[model samples]
Target chain A: MCEILRLAFAAVFVLVVIITIPTKSMGADKEYGQYLSAECNACHAPSKKSGAGIPSLNGKPVPYLVSALLQYKNKSRKNAVMQMIAGRLDSEQINALAAYFSSLGK
Target chain B: MKKISRRQFTNAAALGLGALAIPNIAVGAKPKVVVVGGGAGGATAARYVAKDSKGAVDVTLIEASKRYYTCFYSNLYLGGLRNYGSIGHNYYGLAVNNGVNVVHDWAASVDAQNKRVKLASGSSVSYDRLILSPGIDFKYDSVPGYSAEVQSKMPHAWKSGTQTQLLKRQVLNMRKGGNFVIVPPTNPYRCPPGPYERVSMVAHLLKANNPKAKIIILDPKPKFSKQGLFMDGWERHYPGMIDWVDPGAHGGIKNVDGNKMEIKTDLDTFKADAASVIPAQKAGAIALAAGVNDGDWCPVNPNSMASKADSNIYVLGDASVAKSMPKSGFSANSQAKVAANAVRGELTGSKVFPARYSNTCWSLIATDDGIKVGASYKAGEKKIDVVSKFISKKGESAETRKTTYEESIDWYNGMTADMFS
Candidate 1:
């Protein structure tokens, strides 16, 4: 009976681990994205009204942001500053930033 | 490949559960943060602490003036590009939206040992951490024969507001073909490109209205920031209208007779219809009272912006001795975020990230001609060191310059909103 009880406990613990790992990783990525967003906020605003001549990045679609960043990194975008900034970001960081900005409300 | 067995999975899960159950000891009471000087640094720090902490930290901001006129764009105001109302900002949004306690009063002194501040209103406010961003104060008598009494005649206009308007009025009132003299401050001053931008704007005004009016820059420094770009634009747009005299050529300034509107240099005396005399600067007085200063400026840890003298005290913006960062509003705003994060982490047990900073200074030369210089920085062993830098090219097309000018306007709007709203 003790052997059976130990097996059940192990199965439940394994199930919890399987559930928690991916969620925790996702949460950490979002947090890191928030940190990186601090720099972007210096130019691309998060608030409504979009500032004068600057676009609002809040609530942008993840796919759209990803594509735009990739284009900037590939030198398709004309802005030298944007190209430089985008070139520094890797794919994982790009996805994280997109997710973070997309999660915000306009 | 070896696979994780059920026993290993269970052990890891149990450890994770134990870690989750451990309570955070720093979560006992709300921590209080007091910030002095509600300019770019103080305002951004106050807003971020109040907003991000989500009621975990109480923030109080003390500013002497109710309305803050930004020193960044005051030159544009003088050039008639922006209005007085546009450059001015108030603390109302910070109080109502961000939940910051905005106290419109003078912060007289800092009691560092006790971590309390004494206000001019005779009240004392205590804090768990203090942030001082008191900006810069002019070194009195740095310029010979120049004092507060002579400001009305040769306005510095460095601090913005009424002084800006006064300088603009004096420029407008000058006779046609008259000379306007600008004595830019020595090195390690606020806004390295500022005097040159003012010269550009003044020339812009003269080129249109007072076509024959000439601008004479008596620069103490041999070479100024963005010298190449500024000289290129000046020659292109306002030829024969601007003459820059370096200290070598002018033999340095000797004295100024404000009564006669004349400047006496070792080489020759120059009489002007309008003049701007910017003096050398030091850290604001409160930093010294707080005992956070090395000499003229406060020394802070580059990573966290915490005072090297006292860990609980943080200094940001122009008053802090940031080694590689130019003293500008954008640099102050960037430093504030790094400091804010460190403060929040200490008080609220939030995760602290490595510090990263960036600054871009944009200057409008003509109506549509703009140039910029900027860099990204990371905290190094001893100071914030530059990582990457860029400057506008000398021979950019008109369309590119206009776009750059537009971008600066956007940045102004975005940065202000980020600080206030």
Candidate 2:
């Protein structure tokens, strides 16, 4: 009985640490990403319904956004507006944006 | 395949309780931000700072008029494409929904050192940060013989209020086969493409109503924004009805007699039944009174939009000398966002991003015929320099032009919503 109780307590503590650590870091990243993404709302609509022709960034996969931004920075993407915007962002910013935008619902 | 036992589920639930142990960060007092001139710049700046700060900052907007008539699409109103009421926006939504204190009063002057503004009502308001977006005020003497007194006869409908209505009435009531003269101001005026767009709109109005009427453009600059597109549009839509005279061809405007409805140039004197003499422009009077102006405009840092004279005050829109950015509503709105972010970052513990700006000016020539010129900009050491630019070609498919026109309409709606709502 004593051994079982000790095992349950240890399992719960490990689980809480596992869940809380990533959540805290991601929460901070998402908040900063939101601040950085304000300018993007000028051209790219935040919602899917209003983003015809202009691509909607909300709820996209993180990898897809990272790839797209990288292409824009590398000049593989042909849009001048995206090129100008993406050229200013670094790798950390790109990851944060991807994480924040992907976390949203369409 | 594998199912969790009841004890495992109980352990997972117990783990979730530890997630709520994070302490809340303490923020002491609210910072106050005051914005003057509730146009595109002021309205957007106030809304963003208030909404994004999440009650961390108190924002107040001081505008002389309750109803703001945007000069962006007023030309379309004259062309009969848009109604007069469609271009006007109110501040009720900003006040009620966004928690912005909208004061309908004129900002008479600013005490930058002490960070207080004196209103026309004799009340003074203090602010931690001040945003001045007092759009352009015309230089009355820029065009000889044209002043406030003479505006009744030959209107300069640049401000988009009663002047716009008067100009529209004059255009509609022009005598048959009469000439309509448009005296475009020199460069560095509000809305570089605006005067030409007005010419296009007037041409459209005339072509439909009085087909025999002619339009003569007396321009100070040799070329104008979207010149190729406008020339193409005029030829395709209303050929032989428009005549453009550059400075080289017709010398500079010598004088104007509003009563006689005659404009004299070095080459010849032209008479018109109606005329729009858009005068040269300068920063709004309040900006000069605040002692933030270099000459006719206020200089600002491109990255932060902080006034060169005073760090506490930020100047936006046509009133500031933004080196590469054209003085348009879109540019103002863009600049407002940058300034708002910087201001919020300073007041709150929020993160700040590098400044990037963009603007697209759209013009409608005739029904479903539209063209646009746009550029994306980044902050340089000295100015906001353009990174890339695109313009509509002279000849494009009807479908493309139609799409561009529709896009402009959508943009107007979206931009107004962004500013006021």
Candidate 3:
């Protein structure tokens, strides 16, 4: 009986792990996106004019944002500063940032 | 990681409030955050805390000035590259748009015990968390024969505003072919590259207006930031127009007299038509009054920029000892975001993400000639460590340099917007 109860407790713990992991990541995505966008916001102003040296990211398609950052990271994009900034971002950061930026001005 | 339940937050906060013993007022009333100084750090922190909290936090910013002139780009004004009014900014966006209570008054002192800030207006504003980002204060006596009294005659122009205008007028209207001497400050000051950049801009102005005028640098240090890059640009653009005498070369600065406009050094006593005598520096007075300083600067936690002396207070910008990061406007703005996030989380129980910081300083040598150095930082247990870095090469193409110069203008617009908007 003791052995059986221990096995049941192990099963319940595994279930909790499965339930919690995605939720935690999902909840943190928006907040993390907001926090990390500050890095971009330092140079890419939300109030950027049309002729601004740096291009605006507001209202850009999420896929385009992700693609542009990835290109910069992959050395396909031209600007050295942008490349340096984009190089550090991981896939998770790129996706989340794209989502957050795309959500802006909506 | 386990999700933070309400009871879990309570227990964790109880253990965390070692110094303040602040109760769990997160439930009853919105948390209050008071930020002092309105330059790069303070304004950014105030706006972030207020905007991010979404009306959950009461944020008040205390600044003495009606208009803020950025020290970052003041050199451009001296160079005739930008208008004086172009560099100045106001707080309308932070107050009207972001819901920040902007109080135009001097922050006389900080009451850490009560978490209150005493203003020069005889009013005390209290806070759950107080951010002090009062930049730097000049140690006037650090330079022999230089004091606040003589500052009018030989203006430092280190802190932007009327002093900048005074220095500009002095430079522009000086006698033809006159000597323009600049005494760069010692180490660990704001913008490690500032004095050299100023020299470059001043040289740019003199090259156009008074081509025969001589510019001398009596540097306290044996070396300076971007020495190679600056020297190269100076030679290419203003050849034979600028000379830099290091401490070893000049022996040392013996005395300076504003009335006679002379700098007496061990090597020689040189008469100057105009001069900028930048003095030694310390954390601003309010930080000292707040008892947050260890010696000359407040030591802050690497992860949060919270004062090591007081958990409830965070020190930002040049006033704090941010190891490995130069004291710069960009550095201050970076630190402010981290502090804002941490403060908001402490009050609202919001998820506190890890802190990341980056800074880039751009300097223009002559028309279309620019150079940059930058690094990104991450918080470690003991200190903030550089993760990645880059600098402009010595022999970059003209196209690259022009692009860099233009990029700097855009960055200025973006940085100001980030702070104010």
lDDT of 1 by residue, B102-204 (tens): 9999899988888899999999899988999999998858899999889999999989889999999999999999999999999889999999999999988
**Model 3: CA > 4 A from native:** A1-28, A50-52, B1-27
DockQ, every prediction: 0.52, 0.20, 0.53
TM-scores, in order shown?
0.91, 0.85, 0.91
DockQ of 3: 0.53
| Candidates sorted on lDDT, descending | 3, 1, 2
Top lDDT model: 3
Docking class of 1: medium
Error of 3 at B288 (Å): 0.5
* TM-scores of chain A in all candidate models: 0.75, 0.71, 0.71
In order of listing, the candidates' clash counts read 0, 0, 0
Candidate 3, residues B1-421, lDDT tens digits: the string is: 2434633654465345422323546246667899999999999999999999899889999999989999999999999999999999999999999999999999998878888999999999999899999999999988899999888988899999999999999999889999999998988899988999999999999988999999999989999998999999999999999999999989998999999999999999989999999999999999999999998899999999999999999999999999888999999999999999889878776656678899899999988898989988989888889888888998899999998988998899899999998
Clashing pairs in 1: none
lDDT of 1 at A81: 66
Scoring only the second chain, what is candidate 2's TM-score? Answer: 0.93
State which candidate, 2 or 3, has the greater DockQ. Answer: 3
Chain A TM-score for predicted structure 3:
0.71
